[model samples]
Target: MVEGYAVGIDLGTTNSAIAAVTGDEPEIIPNSDGDRTTPSVVMIDENDETVVGQPAANQAVSKAARTVQHIKRHMGDDDYAVEIDDEQYRPEQVSALILSRLLADAEAYLGRDVDSAVITVPAYFGDAERQATRSAGEIAGIDVEHVMTEPTAACLAYGLQETGDADTSESHEKRHVFVYDLGGGTFDATLVEIDLEHNHIEVKNTDGNRRLGGEDWTQRIVDHLAEIAKEEGDVEIAGDPEQEQRLYDAAVRAKHDLSSREQTEVTVPYLGPNYNLETTLTRETLQELTADLLDQTIDEVDELFERSEHAIEEVDEVLLIGGATRMAQVQETVESYFGMEPLRSINPDEAVALGAATQAELMSASGDTTADDVLPGEEEDLLLVDVTPQPIGIELHDGDFAPVVEQDEKVPISRSDDRFTTVMDDQTGVRFPIYQGQAEEAEDNTKLGEMVLSGIPKAPAGEPTLEINFEVQSDGTLEASATHFESGESVDTTIESGVRLSEKEIEQMREALPTLKDRAVAGAEQKEA
Candidate 1:
């Protein structure tokens, strides 16, 4: 019976938590540490003992080199990792430790093993990032059934069980909704439908930068404080390790304080003693420091709205998700951007987790206990249709980029384009970089992956016929089938480069799991032996 349980998890950059609808409403399972959200910080001390959660954060101020923070940004990166004590830790591994803690806490509370869960990720997360998140679940002994979009999950939480008169029987008309998620480390903006019937909640479009979010705002505030420390306190402690720690913490607290009250007075004694400087940071200061993030979010929202056929006021709701939205300035900025006041009744930090739980409940009730309970790729009638987040294509003659499938092209879309040989008797492999973003040159866009069409037989210059077909289904995953149209041969391969962990690195991570899964397995083996 416990194996039938489905857990909902929100693995954030700053913290992580889990919940499930085993009882009435979804409830967050408290960890043995007496904390619901464990800090997402990790440290590798000189002793090589892995330090996690609050203990890791404690050393962050002093041992910056040995600790990793804001790692959620590099979730799917195959190249990025934390190098401490001459060892590297992948983003998935760092996140796995966080998941390990969540899994242990959920099992400890659920009275039996929690075999499956629906984990939430940023809507703008790329294929690699999404896959990396699923990989973390795998390492944690959890069968990830679905990786729910942050916005979709937020919408479910916003209206689940509490669908008000705005979206009830009499008022169950299809309406558009926007989700703006500004978490500690990243932002995601999504366009969805709220009709309960057709498409249930159709996802129209999504856009956001994985690198911009609340942590960047905090860093900006810290930069300003450092400048003030030098100017006002006559302190020249640029490389002073102790001074750096003091400044980072001071700035973070200042940002948190400015979210509610009008102004916050911060003291930086490390700058000097009673040389003690008290700086008053106002909401205006925060807005000024975080202007770029605000502008970027607004630009993304504006683009979505611009592409819509519906009027501005017709949108049913503007839902805000993520702890950063607690900032009054953030709400005001969103309100101004959308021309409508957004709802805040739901706790941003808990909304996504609660939605994940609701989905888990739906899946369990349906007798679907596997991960990916939520159908992926394009579906019809009851299916939620999603478009390709990027443009897929190959280069043409004269170095022109020919788009095979436009970005946001509707789900279940397929098209074939021809690529001719540019050089005479070219009988080799084809090399092309997969691109995302609207840019004319490959250098300006985000490289998603690479494609190589090989085994082309030598032919007269510009004589080889290459047919490339791109098919992007509802789930937003991309697959391509290319033919030597000349030879009528094709290969269907899903190419996504992910941050890889060597066996040695993976062995180190296993040793760091909150619960020793291998040891437990070995013990069972010994008992059988």
Candidate 2:
């Protein structure tokens, strides 16, 4: 067994939380502010130091240009970066700062150093996004033992807890579960099968939009209020960063209010000395504004059911995960679409982190091990099987995509394709551009990375047999290799997503973390003083 503590983290789009196994059950570790969840916001203070969480979130209205929120949407985007004080901060770097803050808070609460963690990500995230998340953990100076999918984690949290309390005689029945997870910046619909008596959980199929989530709902409100303000008060709130930030905050508050109230009023003051923008928003109106977004999630659910082997009626349970599930519109839509009320036995805000903590505990108790290994626990051995959410392929000479690994395929798998050949006569080398998507054309898919194989013997076009292999680990990262059958030459590489931090940059950022953390702590202390 490991000597140190390993925790589970939900590195969410709008908020983040950490959990650890205490005694026999997983429990959330509160931050220094005694909050169960910390806002996923970061800021550069006046002193040129980093600050995170609520303190940083407080500055969004006052210092809009220096503060960044919702960085998760840009996880795998190579072209996006936040510029603060002439310094460029990549999405991973900003996310790392948030992770570091969570870890520091956990350490302070536990009074011990954390050894490692299992971080959760959206199941539909492709290889590039998953790799970027792992990189964020590295930059945060934490050993990311695994990157479990959010839906799978939610199911684990639910299945294990239910089994722990169930009668042994009644636990033998196999059940199908549909996990509907809508967080701040992403949505995932997953079909899962579980047999508690056998301690088995398998993801049958998964689909989602990485860009659709609660924030989009909030943006709808923001746009509505901005347009109303322009029309009623003749105040321009669109282009001004500070005013936009104020309106955003107000919109978020109104959204939360409408979750439990019939109607809520948003009042954004200080737009001008004598001008105050005030408007009333109803839950019905909010639903009307974001109806298309809700439909998008339902569309994903429809696609999931269509692709999976199980039918909608076969699902015995529907589990709702993420804070956004609290909205009445989301709950109503899900219940209506599934023809049954979704279960929320566990706190939607903490289910993913709790499930991750459960997995981490299993790993620590059994010694460091992979998901395939059945770690002996107090009760029984648990086996989790996850699948790839998107198809991975190589671009052919005709600009078509040839998929090597199809979506919904089981993970910790390896497959090879030998249909590729030399495109030109006497071609000594070939570069294969890899992509991830369902698109027929290579240009339409997302390019993950490229692998080059050289030193091929001179041959006529289509004469050389070239084999390409893809191996996906349990955590969803990809490694690829190519071989020339005639020359018996081979080359392999772990796919590096485009424009992410380099090894040198990661190391540099890791080294700078402690100082950045200290400065943040000092700043907090100064504020309290």
Candidate 3:
């Protein structure tokens, strides 16, 4: 057995969790607060010290300017940052703070050093988003072994935790499942094929809206209350940062309440003189307001089914994931559309973390660590094959996207021989701008990064041959290369998704870790006081 445990982390947009494999079972390692999940929030206290998770979330109401939430939405966007105390901090930095907390909690629980992990991300996340996730893990002092997709992790959890029922027995035939994952901040729908007999889990197709999820639904309620405040009391509640945060917090509570109760009240004080915003929002109204969001998810699922030539009838089962799936409307709408009941056995919040632990065990036993040294049950015969969620290509001479690898293609894959020639004679150098998306125009797609290939043989236009190659690693990282046919020379570069921190920056963050911890301790003490 390995001396140190390789943890599995579900670094989510709204909440995060960590887990580890114990013997043959995988269980969540609760945080110091004893909660199964930790809020993905960070705050810079009045003392300019960093506080993360639930503490930061609690501080958000009174200290809205210093708090950061939903930073996962801005993962790949280089322009996005959380401005705290007049300084801009990148999303990865804030996320690293959260990861650091999880690591600390895990170490406390297991009484060992935890260094390696398999972090889960949205299946539809592009190259930049995946890389950003890895960087976040790095900042947290983790060797992120793999970036598993959320749906895949959920599916893994489902498969490994199977009951002894004959229907799911070892002799049972292969099954196809549709995983509809609507998390707090991101939504992913993946079509997966599971062969229990062979222990193979393959992702057939995936689609999602990176910006849409349960948070948007809650935001809709918050916006509704703001409009009510405007019309009834002539107060601009939304315009104030503190008031907006309070309303959002209230909206979250109301959203949760509506899931179990038909109606809930959202009351926020100090809106205007002689006026307080107190309103009741029925579950029906909440569903009505966010009907389009649900429809949008369905559209993506339908798009996947269409692309894969799959009919709804062919789906053996549909699994609902993410905390948002707890809503009655979400369940009812999905059941009605799929013509089948969605699986509810798995815990949406913990499944990703649990699956990650199982994957961690698998990786530890099979990779680097020898199979003989692993525990008896640690090594499984399972095979996981995932796919890229978007097309990867380079800019063509006509300003069009020349796709070298299409979306939904199996990952850990490499594609090459897509040839391109220089526009002018004696062109000795070529710049390949790598992009990810389905847009026909290169400008419309996301430019992950650029690669410059020099020393190309000078030849007439249309005569010099330069072949571009795109290799997507299993974790969704893209490695693009340019090969010169005549010179037999090749240069390759990784397509970085966003502004990755340098080693020096990582060291700087490390130096600040103790201070951040002190601040969190102080914040907790103050909160308790």
Candidate 4:
């Protein structure tokens, strides 16, 4: 029975968790380590053995160069890698290790295999990043059934939690809801219309940066500590990787501590006695240091509202969903900007995972477990509609970018027969370089992938016309098909350049997983012993 069921995975930037629908309620599935959430960290020991989660995080303090953290920010960068023991590991490969651990935990909790999952990503994740996420799932041996936006998932969790107390007979009108999510490594803001009566949740628009999050705030604290250490202690420790790692860990602890206290001390002991980097960081100081990052999120939210043609006054409620949103300043800023108090009913860290479980339950509902049957008028039957965060296009003559799918376009969208022609006389081939961004010049946009239409009948300029079609699925996956009108020849392929790994690379990682996992288990056992 569990084999056919699907679990929900929050494949987050800093932490990951899994959950599944039990009899009637969705429950978070704790990892094998008995933790509700696992730190998204991966480390390679000096022996070239692999370790993930908390163990990996512990290793990072001592061996910063060998440990990988916040790899999600580099998901779409094909050239980025963490060098370990003279071997390179891509972001997807590292993320796969995290996913593998989560999957193992899910299987343990469910008492059967959990091969299918609905993973959540930041709403603003572009095509390449989403593809890389899927690739990571594949490498982890999971059949990623659907990729849900983080804010949308949060909405589902909120609606589901609120439904039992609402009037089922009344037709509740749709309300425009806003979600401000700031996790450890990414931030996303989304506007959605949720109609409980009609069982519909439609996302209007989403905007955010993958690089901005709590980690940036922590870095601000770390920098402050380094400055104080140099000026007061006269120790130039910031330049050293090992000392920097200790400072980073200490700063993160202090940041979390300051959230509940007026002030916290950041201390990293030096090798010698009487020489350590120690400083008391106040909440006010923390706020001042990271005000610009906070403003950046506010600016993004304002832009989202403007682009969606929605006003701050029109927003019925703003839901905060992320561990970083716990910051008092973040809460106050968002509340003042939106003119409303952000909802904090659900646990920010667990809401996304819980909502993912709800979606997975919807996807795997059987004869006796239909979503409509469970809750009479709940989000179980709610339809989710996502939008593309940026324009998707191909390069044109004179280096202009011709857009096939514009930003804010509702997805699982398909645009067929977008026509283009050859620019030169006797042209035999045409290269369609795909890009995603608002820039007019193709060179200015982020190039995702490209396809070549060759063997076209040699013709004069503008004689050969090709109809290129683009399909962006609900999960933000992109696929293209091109047809030559003269010969009716067509070709189709996925965008593969930036983040999506090749089949051979995926296979290689797949083959390496068992060894990596075995070594990790052995290392854990050794530590326990």
Q: List the residue pairs that clash in candidate 2.
A: none
Off by over 4 Å in 3: 166-171, 365-379, 417-419, 455-460, 484-490, 494-500, 512-514, 518-529
Candidate 2 has its poorest 10 consecutive residues by lDDT at 370-379
The lDDT for every candidate, in the order shown, is 0.71, 0.86, 0.83, 0.82
Instruction: For residues 448-519, write the lDDT of model 4, one tens digit per residue.
Output: 888888888888988787999999876566889888988887788876446667788899978865335553
Error of 3 at 411 (Å): 1.7
- Deviation of model 4 at 98, angstroms: 0.6
Best candidate per TM-score, number? 2
RMSD of candidate 2 to the true fold? 3.0
**Cα error, candidate 2, residue 39 (Å):** 0.3
| Model 3 lDDT tens row, 1-529 | 5477898999888999999986657789988778999999887776767777887788787778888898899887777777766777777778888888888889888988786999999999888788888888888889888989999999888776553343534425677889999999999999999776556789999999898989999999988998999999988885688889988999999999998999987888887787899888999999899999989999998888888956778899888889999988999999998899999889989999998887887787444432222222223456789998988888887889988998899988999864787888999888888888888999888888888889887889988788988888776767788988889777988765635567787777666542365534756565785
TM-scores of the candidates in the order shown: 0.85, 0.92, 0.92, 0.91
> TM-score: which is higher, 3 or 4?
3
For model 3, what is the error of residue 305's alpha carbon versus the real structure, in angstroms, after optimal superposition?
Answer: 1.1
What ranking of all candidate models by TM-score puts the best one first? 2, 3, 4, 1
Clashes of 2: 0
Question: Highest lDDT among the candidates is held by which one?
Answer: 2
Candidate 4: list runs displaced more than 4 Å: 1-5, 168-171, 271-273, 365-368, 373-381, 416-421, 426-428, 454-467, 481-498, 502-504, 514-529
